[model samples]
Target: MLKKIFKQTIQINQIPKYFLASPKPNFPIDKIRNFNIIAHIDHGKSTLADRILEMTGTIVKGEQYLDKLQVEKERGITVKAQTAAMTYEYKGEKYLLNLIDTPGHVDFHYEVSRSMRSCSGSLLLVDACQGIQAQTLSNYEKAKDNGLKIIPVINKIDMPAAHPEEVAENMQLQFDVEKEDIHFISAKTGVGVDGVLRAVVEKLDPPKADINKPFKGFLIDSWFIKDQGVVMLVQVKDGCIAKGEQIMSCAFKKRYDIFEVGILNPEMTPQNSLTAGQVGYIFTNMKAVSDARVGDTFHKPDEEVEPEQGFQEARPMVFAGLYPDDPEDYMQLEKSIYKLALTDPAVHIYKESSAALGNGFRCGFLGLLHMDVFKQRLDDEYNLDCFLTTPSVPYRAKLRNSQKILEVENALMAPDDGLVEHYEEPLAEATILCPKEYVSAVMNLADERRGEQKEINIVDEKRFKLKYTFPLSEIITDFFDKLKSATQGYASLDYYHSGFREAKIKKLVILLMGEPVDSLSFMVHERRAHDFGKNICKKLKEKLPGQQFTVAIQAKLGSKIIAREEIPALRKNVTAKCYGGDYSRKKKLLERQKEGKKNMRSIGRVQIGKDTFVDILKN
Candidate 1:
């Protein structure tokens, strides 16, 4: 009788609902130092992130907490963005520093902008010797367009030839940054890193959130933490939350709780409290990771705040049909893409039925960099076989004859040429920084690609800079390849979209065995199609092995195939190289050639590589 009474009494004790939602944004602007770190590739954005973590005592000294990816450190390039939080105490006041490190490569602008939206300031890093390349200016422009305050940082200043003062002057003059604000530091040596930290403490104000109300925060980034499920790194903008409280992200319509909440120290500190201006992690109890997408907003259930803007579903800029190289691995590839999409929502894949490629969804991306990264990620993360179309960035136009706007990725996808009245091509305005001697070669190469010389500015007696405007279509495929070759990798170019204009553009498709191979297609001005065709034919002919019949290779534009080359059959009684049971090797080579002909594209008696059919455009 006593046990029954006790159990009934315990059950009678009522359980209350756990509350997790965002309150109003009474966040005072003064306390929020919303900023991001932006730089060119190899300019040390991730390394700097590590230094800040160390200086702020966020992680233990000598611990390698940043760039946890082996490939990232091995390749010496940051393929993705990294976010971390730190606290700087000065003048008897503690300040929270929210750091969002962004990719410097051209491909990651979408994610970069998403993260940039959460900040009001940006740190622009310029290589002292490399000066400002295209990506540096592009990222700066992204932040500038978002109306963020910029602190120009001249990184790699420890190098003997680093010209930090000149870089500062160039920034002040070239980009109009304040002279006093350029910070010169070597993130590797930790030199001047403290100065940057002090500047952050001195310059930026921490975020002031409405702590009196329910919890609302910004979802900066998200990734799966293995056995822990999904971990969301967020900034509580205007609210508070306790452990076991459930939260909802208005954008993704996801509800999760504070499974564990705290700053991501070297090892996270489980905290009972987090306030506005705090940078920390919010782990959810959900087993499904897809719900915790990055760049979404989180709030308590009933307490509402102003809806964050730019959460609109991102329209993919480039679309390509994806397929597994090995058809047997198609299912494995499909599963891998889902896992990739969970991390990078921008690299999207949806089901589509194509007449040619069959049932495969068109994959979408932000740019060539995004496409390449997606392809690489699938290969690396899932170890699956996959292939994607050549990267293309869509453009908009209405015919001069008819003002109906047409949005397509390039000349290939644009409406027929006759319908294209006043169609505009994307142009990249570039500044090439290099030693004075390479200026002519760089300028010449640009000209060869139909680039218009905008201006030539002298950087110094030993160095010079040239500005050029080229269609984005031209640069997307091979501009970097050519520029790097001509300059021997010494020249660095910076690019920015210079708007669209009426320009001559054409897509050249190279045909082997009368069938177009996707690999050989490229965008070129109509004027250079003939020479480009010849160069391509030459390159292909050099690569192809000897065969029994003539091989015809040509470049086609729509229905017109131009400049066909026919390779004659290898003549003469072929001498067999035979030594130590290898005597029939040459005869066997002939037999293999004849067998390959059976597999090559005939196009009514012409022969081409069976393997080369789809790979012609890759070069």
Candidate 2:
């Protein structure tokens, strides 16, 4: 049976060139090279990708071609990992090179690792002026763990501050590569780019595949379009996939017919079919975006092929409640979120409600930056106004008089303080890189956040790297911003989950007129609870409008109130209405007014506006 399939594949490859409707990829398996560009944020990965496309004649020298998302363009950062296929000729031999340009921000590290699974080699980029950064080391470790061929490249050599030799020496010492092995290039000016391209074709090993085997591939990404349904980006591993082929997703246990198959030659260009070792997109009749799961394995319906080692499922490290600005737009907001989820499967979404804020979805993300980008996309792509709550990390607590443990992702879900056992907060191991001049300041900042020193290493004469263990909650808050400020924007941070630790954790709830406002509640460490409560109470006092009766704003933990503030009532002059009346009549009227206010205070509800919640939560 395998022999028969091999003969048929050969026959298909032998078909006359003119007989095909579109140009088919006929390169031999040995001539194909699959690789990705990995680096830290602002290291010129996109600029390098542009130069590669121009050199291969796949695209003209123009705007950054791979960063197609509006948020990416506006923020000058790559959010999604983009793919491009190019035909490069060297020494009169044609080669097929598929390049996956991955994002460098720590929030999108999943994209970097996922792209690594589909390729065998990576160009680890570092800005010559910046040298090794926090994410550069992180990505290098990922590449090493995946057993990928790493070709170190120093970018931005054209800059006056670039220190190519110095950077290469550090890379050699850190990555254990020879001094001559590092390639220096100015991706912006296209200098020394040809050498890097040559290295890709010669140094990287071709993928091991057998076209005769059953069709098998992994769905790395998927998104929705207006005219079409879910468009899936697949990395074919073992066999060939063509239009009309029936494929089954192991995750869904359902089969669907392929409507179209093509390669991303920087665009959705349809072709005859995609064979083993090719990265391409496929269109199917399946309309439900939820069905298009990333990291799913697809194979021929009739064949029994073991699933390949797929991508690691993305775990959300921070969660926030997202509510539409207008209550009437709940359904529209739900639809919009689903659409975004199709593109970013890392987001965790579930319907949730709040007493202060109406209907909303509690969404989880990889980090603060990930949550910010998701929110920005909601506004830019869907043109929808949204209100986001304070982001928090998931916490673990033990139930009272029971061994059962509870995981609380939102403050409202936290168990009562009488729980028999103690609480544990998520821990993270952070890698910080900074100039030696600011080492003292960075260490002080980290120490203030309850960080424990793990190790420290000197990268060069002027720079050093530090590893510290911190509560995940701290890292998700303003830690990054504070780090940048302390180091004068010279420090970079990357972190990973490092289990959990026992801590004095409590649920801090906000109360208005003695009524708990669920939306304003959050979990905090006992040590920081007092400060957190006081700050929030002050904010509420400034934001809440004065009511007819005095409104008391209090932050309470368990049965104790930690902070309190009052919004003064709007004083109305009943005497003004009684103008020129007798003094006894005016006194009687004042007493009546006071009595009504006291009664109203007993029964009246505090009128909290949407704007007030938005203001407090955002801060």
Best by lDDT: 2
Model 1 lDDT per residue over 275-346, tens place: 766667777786665676566678887767665666544456566767666557767777777777776666
Q: Tens digits of per-residue lDDT for model 2 on 282-394?
A: 99987876787777889988997887664677788898989988899999999999888877778999999877678999999998888999999999989998878888899
Model 2 scores a TM of 0.89
Give the clash total for candidate 2.
Answer: 0
* C-alpha-based local distance difference test score of model 2: 0.86
Cα RMSD, model 2: 7.6
Error of 2 at 267 (Å): 1.2
Model 2 stretches astray by more than 4 angstroms: 1-26, 401-403, 545-551, 567-605
